[model samples]
Target: MGFPVIRNRRLRGSAAVRNLVRETQLTVHDLIYPLFAVPGTGIKHEIPSMPGVFHLSLDLLDAELDEIVKLGIQGVLLFGVPEHKDETGTSACHDHGIVQEATRHIKKRYPQLLVIADTCLCQFTSHGHCGVVKFNDALQQAEVANDESLELLAETAVSQARAGADIIAPSNMMDGFVHAIRTALDEAGYTHVPIMSYSVKYASAFYGPFRDAAHSAPQFGDRRTYQMDPANAREALREAEADVIEGADFLMVKPALAYMDIIRTLKEHFDLPVVAYNVSAEYSMVKAAAANGWINEKSIVLEMLTGMKRAGADIILTYFAKDVARWLRDTE
Candidate 1:
């Protein structure tokens, strides 16, 4: 029908009508908050690059966790900033590691809250790369040892599962990471825990604030060696396919705002749940614009997240999870 014959304005005539005809509805249940956990007695230092997001100590988590639970956020993706770093990231797999201890504590207190441990070695490695590094004699520079790194990743995943993590999210971008972690989890009798692989993480400029927040900036080289290039869309599918074949329960695309196409592509191709990480720089940009009175933070955030949902994201891991939950509650 033509526009005059079937006027679209009729449906848009009223807010109630618009609400009734809304194609996508974003809810608190679709949100997963990302949290930073550092080892200490009492500390809640906010990252300068990412405002309103704090690097919390284990003792300070009660208040944050309580607020999250009250706001009805389903889960949190946890990253640990250890005080110690080594070549192999041995601290990451220790029984009393920062993340392992934090996992145990959170599960003990809030059994209902899902804790997803980020299984990676960047923050625990002295070199600040995601994996073990070796001097490539031919290349005349250090390169990440992919196969050797898988053992540490597997150990980290099993350790997290043992510490009561509900999910293991590997963000290292290593080849066969999902397979290694899955095998390790099954062998350790943690087959129930699922792997949320960062299958299509791109080497983009959007991770500056996150590196500050997690204290995981590469000391010498960039992550382009392992992380996917942002220019190629077809490569995303192949990356996701590998993880799916390796038994990843959820496939994730990092820095979601610019890569909504990738999110929809994965959703269309994959049968599993597709998660979009609304990354640090995305959040920081909004905050910066809002601070200058250039935009309405609440409305912009709602619209942005809605757009993500409309793009076919089943779940979103975002720094704005708590705020979004509150906004939803207040409106209700």
Candidate 2:
């Protein structure tokens, strides 16, 4: 007979010993709820792809906020589905736009809750692109005009801040967008408004459900031209560096599950807080699999989120925010 000299299972023999030696911890404070707002009264339409999530109108927001706040979630990220669409996405910058109104309502009613507004034009543009597009005569193709798009993105950020957004999250991926929005916000006397830049958002297939929820899929070419390539890791660092230099208060890596390496890289390289978006498609996939009885839903959900935290995500923008918070509370 033989005996092992160092039995690793000794540490796992009890819950107390395991808790004391745990490397990463996930908590309610680490979550930021992503909310979709539409225009209307009494509208709480659930996105079919995302079973438990909803596109709530302003009239029904109170109940939603009440539930979120009661769950101990301190922050929310808002995406607006404007009623009107145009070539320039004019409604996106209007003070009365869906997101603006939602921000104001959320702030007024839940004064302590932090509201992060998604400052982008896709949901408001007729073409469903993140920026303004122009046709190139020589190439006979449409190209996103970077400088012009920056101008509109700045306007959108300022508009969101004026509408009472505590943080302005620019997810458009336009070059110099963070700098442009920072300058615009400061000039407009919103100097205190922080920029949560989507610094390393990839042109990922994991964004499909989000486009359905926000109604922001591009009409023609894909966002690959602007968003980072999933194949590159160094490029993510460069993107994060650019946003940091441009005055981003927080750096975000989108589609957290697939890009945890990027999230960890950004956190290790940058001094600012790192945020990871546990985006819609990621949530939907888990939900679908769990509904099919193929996996242990709750355990997997907690493990996925804890892995993100362990990978260096300081804040997580997740569709599972409320549910995770409730689960954590119940287990505690």
Candidate 3:
């Protein structure tokens, strides 16, 4: 037990020794790739900000899904970009909605693939807010209608479930969203579908690339009212607790790099599978730096993913899923 006799370098002597004594492991099963779904056939448009990501139409999307299955990526988080948007985000809950149609297609073709529908109104709402918005005359700006948004959020969850989404991931951060959606899913005969709640989303600047990819930037205001403040860690626990009490099957912490502590906190306190969202801005930063030759992409990415695992994340929603999968394969 003394310092000289118990030198820790014994386990760090070689690669095989280090591997055998590794406390964390990152695998393909822990990754959930985020994909963009747009309307139109045979189209695969690249997102300008998020370099490697693309907006794939269903036809083009099918081919990618096939590759994803072959690569052994376990799940996908889908964000649909509709041709039209409205004040109420009607497209989000329509029978033939973009996400709904995409869900149906994946289930019919890749029935074994785990499809998690991004159940939020931002991409479909004309105002581009995550929920229904109403102009508040007193505040001199538009304000998201929280209670009213819950009704539509619940409807969206039910619609995605009906379309064969195995998991409904509600990322709006609206009050009572989990409970409302849980009730809606049960009433719609989708009790088997699980809810993956964005329980600890924060109002952070790290989502710019994602907003560009999803086309969900608010036209007028910010999401600070509903999303948690970035400075508060204790509040994340409160939010996670509420989602769990409301029947959320999984809890998520967004912008995972800067929030690893939050991920560990939630994992330590909750029994549900804690998920970490390796956000778009985080991805873009790495890509930008790597492109500039400031760092090594493979090593940094693997370390980042492994760090999340070491931080206690059971799953990670990341843009690096495919790259990480290929990298992991190369080492073996």
Candidate 4:
């Protein structure tokens, strides 16, 4: 099949031909929208760094949910901004916690919609670390207590499951987190609940907009101790392997745009569904360029997301979900 004899351009000659030969497809059903729920009566505050993304209150979720349902978006990943934070992140596992309340509310109204609760303590902890922090005598500074934090992470998973979250997504990046959360969920009589693990989260600068949106930036130190280093690719496989062994139902790579290779690698090596997180910074950059008229937002987003799917992401968690859904529908 030489190029001249093959005449590949024949397939690209028309929209009909292109459609027939298209190897990858992007659809509304592939999207998982991320929503932020804060504790308040009336609030729909737009995140400054991440334009168009709002911090919605429980009372205000109806509009968002209605739109999501209408858009044919299948799932929503939730993050909570509690009214209060503490050393232990007590609110993270409370029955009346912001995320729990939002989950219950969403399920009560839209029972069919998949609600995934983000099981992490960063937004709930006063120090903004994902886990419990303690003074390390050896390191001579306060450090995240991984083993101690596992209990809270497990408790958080159970709490979310109890609150009617369809899935528990643990983004803490702690060792054995999937095993801990899985054990806790099963023990709490939620054996059917699945764990979506952030298997290869990197401590990268690409998360600044997310930290701003979630208000989860560390107060004293960075998350390099727990989050994977950006320099290593093999480490991603080991991380995913551990989560797989620990019973993670889905493995996700955060900040997806720059990590498409990792996404492809995981899909090639793992049987479980691989998810790609089109993180805040990645979203904001496109929004910024689009706002400045430097790029066509729809074309760029469509191309980028299609590339992710082509890279073998089974599902994508993205802020652009709503727009992408609408775009796909309009095109159809």
Instruction: Report backbone clashes per prediction.
Output: 0, 0, 0, 0
* TM-score on alpha carbons, each prediction: 0.98, 0.97, 0.98, 0.98
TM-score, candidate 4, is 0.98
User: Tens digit of lDDT per residue, candidate 1, span 234-291?
Assistant: 9999999999999999999997999999999999998999999999999999999999
**Model 2 clash number:** 0
Query: Compared with the true structure, what per-residue lDDT tens digits does model 3 show for residues 50-84?
Result: 88899999988878898899999978998899999
Name the better of 1 and 3 by TM-score: 1
TM-score of 2: 0.97
lDDT to native, each model: 0.94, 0.93, 0.93, 0.94
Off by over 4 Å in 3: 1-5
| Candidate with more favorable, higher lDDT: 2 or 4 | 4
Q: Is candidate 1 or candidate 2 better by TM-score?
A: 1
